[model samples]
Target chain A: MAIFRWGMHFDPLAHLRQIQRELDRVSWPWTAGARRIGGGTYPPVNVYESDAEVVVQCEVAGVEPSDLDVSITGETLTVKGIKKPLPREEELNFIRRERGSGEFTRTVVLPNEVDAEKVEANLRDGVMTIRLPKKAAGKPTRVEIKG
Target chain B: MAQDKSVKVKTTVSAAEAAEDAFSPLVDIYEKDDGLVLVADVPGASKGDISVQVDKGVLTLAAEARFDVPGEAYSRTYLSFEPGRFFRAFALSDEIDRDRITATVSKGVLTVELPKAEAARSRKIEIKVLE
Candidate 1:
Protein backbone atom coordinates (compact mmCIF):
# COMPACT_ATOMS: atom_id res chain seq x y z
CA MET A 1 0.00 0.00 0.00
CA ALA A 2 1.22 3.53 -0.83
CA ILE A 3 0.45 6.56 1.32
CA PHE A 4 -0.12 9.82 -0.49
CA ARG A 5 0.29 13.09 1.39
CA TRP A 6 -2.37 15.74 0.79
CA GLY A 7 -3.35 19.17 2.13
CA MET A 8 0.17 20.51 1.45
CA HIS A 9 0.17 24.28 1.25
CA PHE A 10 0.08 25.20 -2.41
CA ASP A 11 1.67 28.31 -3.85
CA PRO A 12 -0.27 29.82 -6.72
CA LEU A 13 2.64 32.03 -7.76
CA ALA A 14 4.92 29.04 -8.21
CA HIS A 15 2.33 27.34 -10.39
CA LEU A 16 1.99 30.45 -12.50
CA ARG A 17 5.74 30.60 -12.97
CA GLN A 18 5.80 26.98 -14.09
CA ILE A 19 3.04 27.65 -16.59
CA GLN A 20 4.89 30.71 -17.90
CA ARG A 21 8.05 28.68 -18.42
CA GLU A 22 6.15 25.98 -20.29
CA LEU A 23 4.49 28.59 -22.49
CA ASP A 24 7.87 30.16 -23.25
CA ARG A 25 9.15 26.79 -24.41
CA VAL A 26 6.28 26.00 -26.78
CA SER A 27 6.01 29.52 -28.17
CA TRP A 28 9.59 29.58 -29.46
CA PRO A 29 9.79 30.14 -33.23
CA TRP A 30 10.59 26.91 -35.11
CA THR A 31 11.97 28.63 -38.21
CA ALA A 32 15.21 29.66 -36.48
CA GLY A 33 17.55 27.40 -38.44
CA ALA A 34 18.19 23.90 -37.06
CA ARG A 35 16.07 23.28 -34.00
CA ARG A 36 18.33 23.27 -30.96
CA ILE A 37 17.59 20.67 -28.35
CA GLY A 38 16.94 22.07 -24.85
CA GLY A 39 17.03 25.56 -26.32
CA GLY A 40 15.85 28.61 -24.34
CA THR A 41 18.83 30.20 -22.63
CA TYR A 42 22.44 29.11 -22.36
CA PRO A 43 23.25 30.34 -18.84
CA PRO A 44 20.92 31.10 -15.93
CA VAL A 45 21.47 34.03 -13.57
CA ASN A 46 20.69 35.25 -10.01
CA VAL A 47 20.37 38.85 -8.87
CA TYR A 48 20.96 40.13 -5.31
CA GLU A 49 20.30 43.58 -3.97
CA SER A 50 22.07 45.24 -1.05
CA ASP A 51 22.14 48.70 0.42
CA ALA A 52 25.44 49.47 -1.30
CA GLU A 53 25.37 47.55 -4.54
CA VAL A 54 23.36 45.24 -6.76
CA VAL A 55 25.12 41.93 -7.43
CA VAL A 56 24.36 39.60 -10.31
CA GLN A 57 25.81 36.14 -10.73
CA CYS A 58 25.61 34.05 -13.89
CA GLU A 59 26.50 30.39 -14.35
CA VAL A 60 28.61 30.15 -17.51
CA ALA A 61 30.70 27.02 -17.39
CA GLY A 62 32.87 26.22 -20.44
CA VAL A 63 32.37 29.75 -21.78
CA GLU A 64 35.36 31.89 -22.61
CA PRO A 65 35.64 35.35 -21.07
CA SER A 66 36.36 36.96 -24.43
CA ASP A 67 33.03 35.78 -25.80
CA LEU A 68 30.99 37.56 -23.08
CA ASP A 69 29.52 41.06 -23.41
CA VAL A 70 28.00 43.03 -20.49
CA SER A 71 26.21 46.34 -20.92
CA ILE A 72 23.91 48.51 -18.85
CA THR A 73 21.27 50.94 -20.07
CA GLY A 74 19.50 52.92 -17.35
CA GLU A 75 18.30 50.43 -14.73
CA THR A 76 18.55 47.35 -16.91
CA LEU A 77 21.66 45.19 -17.16
CA THR A 78 22.18 42.93 -20.18
CA VAL A 79 24.51 39.95 -20.30
CA LYS A 80 25.23 38.28 -23.64
CA GLY A 81 27.53 35.37 -24.38
CA ILE A 82 28.01 32.22 -26.43
CA LYS A 83 28.70 28.79 -24.99
CA LYS A 84 30.72 26.72 -27.45
CA PRO A 85 30.23 23.00 -27.30
CA LEU A 86 33.15 20.74 -26.50
CA PRO A 87 35.07 19.38 -29.48
CA ARG A 88 34.68 15.66 -30.03
CA GLU A 89 35.47 13.09 -32.73
CA GLU A 90 33.08 12.86 -35.64
CA GLU A 91 32.06 9.31 -34.76
CA LEU A 92 31.41 10.18 -31.15
CA ASN A 93 27.85 9.69 -29.98
CA PHE A 94 26.28 11.37 -26.96
CA ILE A 95 24.41 9.23 -24.47
CA ARG A 96 22.73 12.13 -22.71
CA ARG A 97 22.80 15.89 -23.32
CA GLU A 98 20.87 18.36 -21.15
CA ARG A 99 23.09 21.42 -21.27
CA GLY A 100 22.23 24.15 -23.73
CA SER A 101 24.85 25.68 -26.04
CA GLY A 102 24.92 28.70 -28.39
CA GLU A 103 24.16 32.38 -28.05
CA PHE A 104 22.07 33.64 -25.12
CA THR A 105 21.02 37.06 -23.84
CA ARG A 106 19.60 37.86 -20.38
CA THR A 107 18.36 41.32 -19.52
CA VAL A 108 17.36 42.08 -15.90
CA VAL A 109 15.85 45.26 -14.57
CA LEU A 110 17.17 46.39 -11.19
CA PRO A 111 14.74 47.58 -8.53
CA ASN A 112 16.82 50.65 -7.83
CA GLU A 113 19.16 52.90 -9.77
CA VAL A 114 22.82 51.97 -10.04
CA ASP A 115 26.03 53.71 -11.02
CA ALA A 116 26.79 52.06 -14.33
CA GLU A 117 30.26 53.63 -14.55
CA LYS A 118 31.41 52.03 -11.30
CA VAL A 119 30.14 48.52 -12.08
CA GLU A 120 32.65 45.69 -11.61
CA ALA A 121 32.60 42.29 -13.28
CA ASN A 122 34.63 39.20 -12.42
CA LEU A 123 34.64 35.66 -13.75
CA ARG A 124 35.99 32.75 -11.77
CA ASP A 125 35.76 29.00 -12.16
CA GLY A 126 32.95 29.49 -14.78
CA VAL A 127 30.77 31.80 -12.64
CA MET A 128 30.61 35.48 -13.51
CA THR A 129 29.81 38.03 -10.77
CA ILE A 130 28.85 41.56 -11.68
CA ARG A 131 28.59 44.22 -8.96
CA LEU A 132 26.95 47.52 -9.67
CA PRO A 133 27.16 50.25 -7.04
CA LYS A 134 23.81 51.77 -6.09
CA LYS A 135 23.30 55.43 -6.85
CA ALA A 136 23.06 57.94 -4.00
CA ALA A 137 19.45 58.57 -4.82
CA GLY A 138 18.63 54.90 -4.60
CA LYS A 139 19.93 54.53 -1.05
CA PRO A 140 17.44 54.68 1.79
CA THR A 141 17.55 58.02 3.63
CA ARG A 142 17.02 58.22 7.37
CA VAL A 143 15.07 61.23 8.56
CA GLU A 144 15.83 62.63 12.02
CA ILE A 145 12.80 62.98 14.32
CA LYS A 146 12.66 66.14 16.51
CA GLY A 147 12.19 65.41 20.22
CA MET B 1 31.87 -5.86 -2.64
CA ALA B 2 33.43 -4.04 0.31
CA GLN B 3 32.92 -0.71 -1.42
CA ASP B 4 29.30 -1.55 -2.06
CA LYS B 5 28.76 -2.26 1.62
CA SER B 6 30.25 1.08 2.53
CA VAL B 7 27.95 2.88 0.08
CA LYS B 8 24.89 1.24 1.58
CA VAL B 9 25.93 2.37 5.03
CA LYS B 10 26.35 5.97 3.88
CA THR B 11 22.93 6.28 2.32
CA THR B 12 20.47 4.75 4.80
CA VAL B 13 17.40 6.55 3.47
CA SER B 14 16.07 5.68 0.05
CA ALA B 15 15.58 8.26 -2.71
CA ALA B 16 11.86 8.43 -2.08
CA GLU B 17 12.49 9.40 1.53
CA ALA B 18 14.75 12.28 0.65
CA ALA B 19 13.81 15.84 1.62
CA GLU B 20 11.30 17.64 -0.54
CA ASP B 21 13.73 20.53 -1.08
CA ALA B 22 16.34 18.36 -2.77
CA PHE B 23 16.85 19.29 -6.43
CA SER B 24 18.51 17.58 -9.37
CA PRO B 25 21.29 19.29 -11.26
CA LEU B 26 21.39 19.50 -15.04
CA VAL B 27 23.98 17.26 -16.67
CA ASP B 28 25.38 16.53 -20.11
CA ILE B 29 27.08 13.23 -20.95
CA TYR B 30 29.42 12.71 -23.89
CA GLU B 31 31.32 9.74 -25.29
CA LYS B 32 34.94 10.19 -26.28
CA ASP B 33 37.97 8.21 -27.48
CA ASP B 34 39.15 7.47 -23.95
CA GLY B 35 35.84 7.19 -22.15
CA LEU B 36 32.64 9.00 -21.21
CA VAL B 37 32.51 12.43 -19.60
CA LEU B 38 29.63 13.72 -17.48
CA VAL B 39 29.30 17.45 -16.93
CA ALA B 40 26.89 18.76 -14.31
CA ASP B 41 25.92 22.27 -13.37
CA VAL B 42 25.73 22.71 -9.58
CA PRO B 43 25.73 26.39 -8.91
CA GLY B 44 26.85 27.66 -5.46
CA ALA B 45 28.57 24.39 -4.68
CA SER B 46 32.31 24.69 -4.22
CA LYS B 47 34.89 22.13 -5.31
CA GLY B 48 35.63 21.06 -1.75
CA ASP B 49 31.99 20.54 -0.83
CA ILE B 50 31.01 18.31 -3.76
CA SER B 51 31.29 14.54 -3.44
CA VAL B 52 31.38 11.89 -6.19
CA GLN B 53 31.33 8.20 -5.37
CA VAL B 54 30.82 4.95 -7.26
CA ASP B 55 29.85 1.63 -5.74
CA LYS B 56 28.30 -1.56 -7.05
CA GLY B 57 28.00 -0.11 -10.56
CA VAL B 58 26.12 2.91 -9.23
CA LEU B 59 27.49 6.45 -9.30
CA THR B 60 26.16 8.98 -6.82
CA LEU B 61 26.67 12.73 -6.89
CA ALA B 62 25.92 14.81 -3.81
CA ALA B 63 26.54 18.44 -2.98
CA GLU B 64 25.14 21.37 -1.03
CA ALA B 65 25.08 24.99 -2.14
CA ARG B 66 26.32 27.57 0.38
CA PHE B 67 24.28 30.75 0.60
CA ASP B 68 25.48 33.87 2.34
CA VAL B 69 22.79 36.15 3.68
CA PRO B 70 23.60 39.81 3.41
CA GLY B 71 23.28 42.27 6.34
CA GLU B 72 20.30 44.21 5.09
CA ALA B 73 17.07 42.71 3.80
CA TYR B 74 15.44 43.78 0.56
CA SER B 75 12.83 42.63 -1.91
CA ARG B 76 13.80 40.44 -4.86
CA THR B 77 12.69 40.50 -8.45
CA TYR B 78 13.63 36.86 -9.19
CA LEU B 79 14.46 34.52 -6.36
CA SER B 80 15.95 31.37 -7.85
CA PHE B 81 18.21 30.36 -5.00
CA GLU B 82 16.76 27.85 -2.58
CA PRO B 83 19.69 26.58 -0.59
CA GLY B 84 19.60 22.82 -0.19
CA ARG B 85 21.30 19.59 -1.21
CA PHE B 86 21.61 18.49 -4.83
CA PHE B 87 21.67 14.76 -5.40
CA ARG B 88 21.57 12.36 -8.33
CA ALA B 89 22.54 8.78 -9.08
CA PHE B 90 23.16 6.72 -12.21
CA ALA B 91 23.85 3.02 -12.77
CA LEU B 92 26.93 2.05 -14.74
CA SER B 93 27.41 -0.86 -17.11
CA ASP B 94 30.14 -3.46 -16.92
CA GLU B 95 32.05 -1.93 -19.82
CA ILE B 96 33.30 0.94 -17.71
CA ASP B 97 36.63 0.91 -15.86
CA ARG B 98 35.44 1.43 -12.30
CA ASP B 99 38.85 1.80 -10.69
CA ARG B 100 40.18 4.41 -13.12
CA ILE B 101 37.29 6.82 -12.80
CA THR B 102 38.19 10.44 -12.00
CA ALA B 103 36.29 13.65 -11.26
CA THR B 104 36.97 17.38 -10.98
CA VAL B 105 34.84 20.36 -10.04
CA SER B 106 35.39 23.90 -11.29
CA LYS B 107 33.29 27.04 -11.49
CA GLY B 108 30.29 25.21 -10.02
CA VAL B 109 30.49 22.52 -12.73
CA LEU B 110 31.42 18.93 -12.00
CA THR B 111 33.07 16.76 -14.64
CA VAL B 112 33.28 13.00 -14.12
CA GLU B 113 35.40 10.83 -16.39
CA LEU B 114 34.55 7.15 -16.74
CA PRO B 115 37.16 5.23 -18.67
CA LYS B 116 36.30 2.14 -20.62
CA ALA B 117 37.72 -1.28 -19.74
CA GLU B 118 40.49 -2.87 -21.81
CA ALA B 119 38.11 -5.27 -23.56
CA ALA B 120 35.63 -2.50 -24.23
CA ARG B 121 38.03 -0.22 -26.15
CA SER B 122 38.03 -0.29 -29.94
CA ARG B 123 41.07 -1.78 -31.67
CA LYS B 124 42.12 -2.96 -35.09
CA ILE B 125 43.55 -6.44 -35.68
CA GLU B 126 45.76 -7.57 -38.58
CA ILE B 127 45.47 -11.02 -40.20
CA LYS B 128 48.62 -13.19 -40.28
CA VAL B 129 49.02 -16.23 -42.48
CA LEU B 130 50.71 -19.32 -41.01
CA GLU B 131 53.87 -20.28 -42.99
Candidate 2:
Protein backbone atom coordinates (compact mmCIF):
# COMPACT_ATOMS: atom_id res chain seq x y z
CA MET A 1 0.00 0.00 0.00
CA ALA A 2 1.22 3.51 -0.78
CA ILE A 3 1.57 5.25 2.57
CA PHE A 4 1.61 8.86 1.39
CA ARG A 5 -0.34 10.55 -1.38
CA TRP A 6 -1.07 14.24 -2.03
CA GLY A 7 -4.03 14.91 -4.29
CA MET A 8 -4.50 13.36 -7.74
CA HIS A 9 -1.19 14.28 -9.39
CA PHE A 10 0.21 17.45 -7.87
CA ASP A 11 3.85 17.58 -6.80
CA PRO A 12 4.20 21.00 -5.25
CA LEU A 13 7.66 20.26 -3.89
CA ALA A 14 9.25 19.58 -7.27
CA HIS A 15 7.44 22.50 -8.86
CA LEU A 16 8.55 24.85 -6.12
CA ARG A 17 12.18 23.85 -6.64
CA GLN A 18 11.87 24.46 -10.36
CA ILE A 19 10.46 27.90 -9.77
CA GLN A 20 13.21 28.69 -7.29
CA ARG A 21 15.86 27.70 -9.85
CA GLU A 22 14.27 29.92 -12.49
CA LEU A 23 14.16 32.86 -10.12
CA ASP A 24 17.80 32.31 -9.25
CA ARG A 25 18.78 32.29 -12.90
CA VAL A 26 16.91 35.54 -13.55
CA SER A 27 18.40 37.32 -10.56
CA TRP A 28 21.93 36.20 -11.35
CA PRO A 29 22.48 36.49 -15.10
CA TRP A 30 25.84 34.78 -14.80
CA THR A 31 25.10 31.06 -14.81
CA ALA A 32 28.43 30.30 -13.14
CA GLY A 33 27.69 32.75 -10.31
CA ALA A 34 24.28 31.20 -9.78
CA ARG A 35 25.72 27.72 -9.69
CA ARG A 36 28.38 28.69 -7.17
CA ILE A 37 25.86 30.42 -4.89
CA GLY A 38 23.47 27.49 -5.09
CA GLY A 39 26.10 24.87 -4.31
CA GLY A 40 27.20 26.60 -1.12
CA THR A 41 23.73 26.60 0.44
CA TYR A 42 23.61 22.90 1.17
CA PRO A 43 20.49 22.67 3.31
CA PRO A 44 17.19 24.36 2.44
CA VAL A 45 15.29 26.30 5.11
CA ASN A 46 11.74 27.44 5.88
CA VAL A 47 10.80 30.43 7.98
CA TYR A 48 7.45 31.07 9.66
CA GLU A 49 6.25 33.78 12.01
CA SER A 50 3.52 33.78 14.61
CA ASP A 51 2.26 36.54 16.90
CA ALA A 52 4.92 35.92 19.51
CA GLU A 53 7.92 34.52 17.69
CA VAL A 54 9.60 33.64 14.44
CA VAL A 55 10.64 30.06 13.75
CA VAL A 56 13.14 28.67 11.27
CA GLN A 57 13.59 25.07 10.27
CA CYS A 58 16.48 23.78 8.21
CA GLU A 59 17.10 20.36 6.70
CA VAL A 60 20.57 19.23 7.73
CA ALA A 61 20.87 15.49 7.56
CA GLY A 62 24.22 13.73 8.08
CA VAL A 63 25.49 16.79 9.96
CA GLU A 64 26.84 16.23 13.42
CA PRO A 65 25.70 18.44 16.26
CA SER A 66 29.28 19.26 17.14
CA ASP A 67 29.90 20.63 13.68
CA LEU A 68 26.91 22.99 13.75
CA ASP A 69 27.12 26.62 14.80
CA VAL A 70 24.15 28.99 15.07
CA SER A 71 24.35 32.71 15.81
CA ILE A 72 22.06 35.68 15.77
CA THR A 73 22.91 39.34 15.15
CA GLY A 74 20.25 42.07 15.15
CA GLU A 75 17.51 40.60 12.92
CA THR A 76 19.67 38.05 11.16
CA LEU A 77 20.09 34.38 12.03
CA THR A 78 23.04 32.39 10.75
CA VAL A 79 23.44 28.63 10.67
CA LYS A 80 26.72 27.01 9.76
CA GLY A 81 27.62 23.34 9.67
CA ILE A 82 29.82 20.73 8.06
CA LYS A 83 28.49 17.44 6.75
CA LYS A 84 31.14 14.75 6.63
CA PRO A 85 30.97 11.97 4.09
CA LEU A 86 30.54 8.45 5.33
CA PRO A 87 33.55 6.20 5.55
CA ARG A 88 33.94 3.74 2.70
CA GLU A 89 36.21 0.79 2.08
CA GLU A 90 38.76 0.78 -0.74
CA GLU A 91 36.89 -2.00 -2.55
CA LEU A 92 33.56 -0.23 -2.20
CA ASN A 93 31.99 1.01 -5.42
CA PHE A 94 29.18 3.56 -5.49
CA ILE A 95 26.48 3.01 -8.07
CA ARG A 96 24.88 6.38 -7.31
CA ARG A 97 26.10 9.43 -5.37
CA GLU A 98 23.43 12.09 -5.11
CA ARG A 99 23.93 13.56 -1.63
CA GLY A 100 26.59 16.26 -1.39
CA SER A 101 28.73 16.73 1.73
CA GLY A 102 30.74 19.78 2.76
CA GLU A 103 30.61 22.97 4.77
CA PHE A 104 27.56 25.27 4.45
CA THR A 105 26.49 28.59 5.93
CA ARG A 106 22.99 30.10 5.58
CA THR A 107 21.95 33.45 6.99
CA VAL A 108 18.35 34.69 6.97
CA VAL A 109 16.89 38.07 7.89
CA LEU A 110 13.93 38.04 10.25
CA PRO A 111 10.78 39.97 9.39
CA ASN A 112 10.54 41.58 12.81
CA GLU A 113 12.87 42.46 15.64
CA VAL A 114 13.42 39.54 18.02
CA ASP A 115 15.01 39.06 21.42
CA ALA A 116 18.15 37.22 20.56
CA GLU A 117 18.74 36.28 24.19
CA LYS A 118 15.54 34.25 24.25
CA VAL A 119 16.25 32.33 21.03
CA GLU A 120 16.02 28.56 21.28
CA ALA A 121 17.21 25.83 18.92
CA ASN A 122 16.87 22.09 18.70
CA LEU A 123 18.11 19.49 16.26
CA ARG A 124 16.07 16.38 15.85
CA ASP A 125 15.96 13.69 13.20
CA GLY A 126 18.12 15.82 10.88
CA VAL A 127 15.92 18.91 11.14
CA MET A 128 17.07 21.97 13.06
CA THR A 129 14.37 24.23 14.44
CA ILE A 130 15.21 27.68 15.81
CA ARG A 131 12.68 29.82 17.59
CA LEU A 132 13.26 33.55 17.98
CA PRO A 133 10.98 35.30 20.40
CA LYS A 134 9.62 38.61 19.15
CA LYS A 135 10.41 41.53 21.45
CA ALA A 136 7.51 42.90 23.42
CA ALA A 137 8.07 46.39 21.98
CA GLY A 138 8.13 45.05 18.47
CA LYS A 139 4.53 43.77 18.65
CA PRO A 140 1.80 45.95 17.24
CA THR A 141 -0.18 47.70 19.97
CA ARG A 142 -3.91 48.28 19.51
CA VAL A 143 -5.24 51.64 20.76
CA GLU A 144 -8.75 51.95 22.25
CA ILE A 145 -11.28 53.55 19.81
CA LYS A 146 -13.49 56.20 21.42
CA GLY A 147 -17.16 55.43 20.80
CA MET B 1 26.68 -14.66 -17.58
CA ALA B 2 23.14 -15.57 -16.60
CA GLN B 3 23.33 -13.52 -13.39
CA ASP B 4 24.56 -10.48 -15.31
CA LYS B 5 21.66 -10.82 -17.74
CA SER B 6 19.11 -10.97 -14.92
CA VAL B 7 20.61 -7.91 -13.20
CA LYS B 8 20.33 -5.91 -16.42
CA VAL B 9 16.72 -6.90 -16.86
CA LYS B 10 15.83 -5.85 -13.31
CA THR B 11 17.41 -2.43 -13.79
CA THR B 12 15.35 -1.72 -16.88
CA VAL B 13 12.12 -2.80 -15.19
CA SER B 14 12.72 -0.49 -12.23
CA ALA B 15 13.65 2.42 -14.46
CA ALA B 16 10.36 2.14 -16.28
CA GLU B 17 8.43 2.03 -13.01
CA ALA B 18 9.62 5.50 -11.92
CA ALA B 19 6.67 7.81 -11.36
CA GLU B 20 6.34 11.54 -12.01
CA ASP B 21 4.99 12.69 -8.64
CA ALA B 22 7.35 10.70 -6.50
CA PHE B 23 10.57 12.41 -5.43
CA SER B 24 13.60 10.17 -5.13
CA PRO B 25 15.62 10.76 -1.97
CA LEU B 26 19.33 11.35 -2.35
CA VAL B 27 21.18 8.15 -1.47
CA ASP B 28 24.74 6.85 -1.17
CA ILE B 29 25.43 3.13 -1.44
CA TYR B 30 28.63 1.63 -0.07
CA GLU B 31 29.93 -1.90 -0.20
CA LYS B 32 31.76 -3.44 2.75
CA ASP B 33 33.15 -6.84 3.59
CA ASP B 34 29.89 -8.03 5.10
CA GLY B 35 27.28 -6.28 2.99
CA LEU B 36 26.15 -3.10 1.29
CA VAL B 37 25.16 -0.04 3.33
CA LEU B 38 22.74 2.48 1.83
CA VAL B 39 22.48 5.92 3.40
CA ALA B 40 19.52 8.01 2.30
CA ASP B 41 18.96 11.72 3.03
CA VAL B 42 15.34 12.01 4.06
CA PRO B 43 15.10 15.24 6.03
CA GLY B 44 11.92 15.82 8.07
CA ALA B 45 11.16 12.11 8.27
CA SER B 46 10.84 11.07 11.88
CA LYS B 47 11.12 7.59 13.35
CA GLY B 48 7.55 6.41 12.82
CA ASP B 49 7.23 8.14 9.46
CA ILE B 50 9.64 5.92 7.53
CA SER B 51 9.15 2.37 6.28
CA VAL B 52 11.56 -0.10 4.72
CA GLN B 53 10.34 -3.19 2.92
CA VAL B 54 11.69 -5.91 0.68
CA ASP B 55 9.48 -7.60 -1.84
CA LYS B 56 10.51 -9.87 -4.73
CA GLY B 57 14.20 -9.04 -4.37
CA VAL B 58 13.50 -5.34 -4.30
CA LEU B 59 14.18 -2.95 -1.41
CA THR B 60 11.97 0.12 -1.12
CA LEU B 61 12.08 3.15 1.17
CA ALA B 62 9.06 5.37 1.82
CA ALA B 63 9.11 8.42 4.08
CA GLU B 64 6.79 11.33 4.87
CA ALA B 65 7.52 14.47 6.82
CA ARG B 66 5.16 15.65 9.56
CA PHE B 67 5.03 19.41 9.08
CA ASP B 68 1.87 21.08 10.37
CA VAL B 69 2.68 24.68 11.18
CA PRO B 70 -0.14 26.82 12.52
CA GLY B 71 0.82 30.07 10.83
CA GLU B 72 1.39 30.82 7.16
CA ALA B 73 4.93 31.02 5.86
CA TYR B 74 6.04 34.65 5.67
CA SER B 75 9.10 34.15 3.46
CA ARG B 76 11.00 31.46 1.57
CA THR B 77 14.52 32.33 0.57
CA TYR B 78 16.43 29.09 -0.07
CA LEU B 79 14.16 26.09 -0.06
CA SER B 80 15.61 23.32 -2.18
CA PHE B 81 12.14 21.84 -2.17
CA GLU B 82 9.03 21.86 -0.06
CA PRO B 83 8.85 19.25 2.63
CA GLY B 84 6.81 16.24 1.53
CA ARG B 85 6.86 12.49 1.04
CA PHE B 86 9.62 10.67 -0.84
CA PHE B 87 9.89 7.20 -2.38
CA ARG B 88 12.86 5.21 -3.66
CA ALA B 89 13.46 1.55 -4.52
CA PHE B 90 16.42 -0.63 -5.35
CA ALA B 91 16.58 -4.04 -7.04
CA LEU B 92 18.48 -6.32 -4.70
CA SER B 93 20.23 -9.32 -6.17
CA ASP B 94 20.15 -12.86 -4.85
CA GLU B 95 23.51 -12.35 -3.18
CA ILE B 96 21.89 -10.30 -0.42
CA ASP B 97 20.61 -11.98 2.74
CA ARG B 98 17.17 -10.43 2.75
CA ASP B 99 16.30 -11.83 6.16
CA ARG B 100 19.34 -10.27 7.82
CA ILE B 101 18.84 -6.78 6.47
CA THR B 102 18.63 -4.03 9.11
CA ALA B 103 17.68 -0.37 9.06
CA THR B 104 17.95 2.65 11.36
CA VAL B 105 16.77 6.25 11.13
CA SER B 106 18.54 9.15 12.80
CA LYS B 107 18.66 12.93 12.26
CA GLY B 108 16.64 12.47 9.03
CA VAL B 109 19.03 9.95 7.52
CA LEU B 110 18.15 6.30 6.93
CA THR B 111 20.86 3.67 6.99
CA VAL B 112 20.09 0.23 5.61
CA GLU B 113 22.53 -2.63 5.93
CA LEU B 114 22.03 -5.47 3.48
CA PRO B 115 24.23 -8.35 4.53
CA LYS B 116 25.53 -10.70 1.89
CA ALA B 117 24.37 -14.30 1.94
CA GLU B 118 26.74 -16.94 3.26
CA ALA B 119 27.57 -18.24 -0.18
CA ALA B 120 28.17 -14.77 -1.51
CA ARG B 121 30.57 -13.63 1.22
CA SER B 122 34.29 -13.77 0.49
CA ARG B 123 36.18 -16.60 2.19
CA LYS B 124 39.89 -17.19 2.05
CA ILE B 125 40.79 -20.59 0.68
CA GLU B 126 43.89 -22.47 1.84
CA ILE B 127 45.84 -24.84 -0.47
CA LYS B 128 48.11 -27.61 0.79
CA VAL B 129 50.88 -29.51 -1.05
CA LEU B 130 49.65 -32.63 -2.77
CA GLU B 131 52.52 -34.54 -1.07
The candidate that wins on DockQ is 2
Model 2: per-residue Cα lDDT over A1-147, one tens digit each: 113311133455878878877887787654412122123356777677767888788888878899999998877788989998776434568766778777888878776788989998888768888889888874577899999
lDDT tens digits, residues B5-111, model 1? 11111322234423234567778888877789888877667766677777678878887766443434633434444445777778988888888877877666778
Per-residue lDDT tens digits for candidate 2, residues B1-131, read 22211111111223333323455788888787888989898877876777777778888777776654434544332244555666777899899998888787777888888899999999999988798
Q: Which residue pairs show backbone clashes in model 2?
A: A125-B107, A125-B108, A126-B107
Kindly report which residue stretches of model 1 are placed more than 4 angstroms away from their true locations once superposed: A1-42, A89-91, A138-147, B1-20, B67-72, B128-131
Give Cα distance to truth, residue A42, candidate 2, Å.
Answer: 1.2
- The per-model DockQ list reads 0.21, 0.27
Cα shift from native, residue A81, model 2 (Å): 1.1
Fraction of the true interface contacts (Cα pairs closer than 8 Å across chains) found in each model: 0.40, 0.52
Candidate 2 clash figure, as a count: 3
TM-score of chain A of each: 0.64, 0.64
C-alpha TM-score for every candidate: 0.70, 0.70
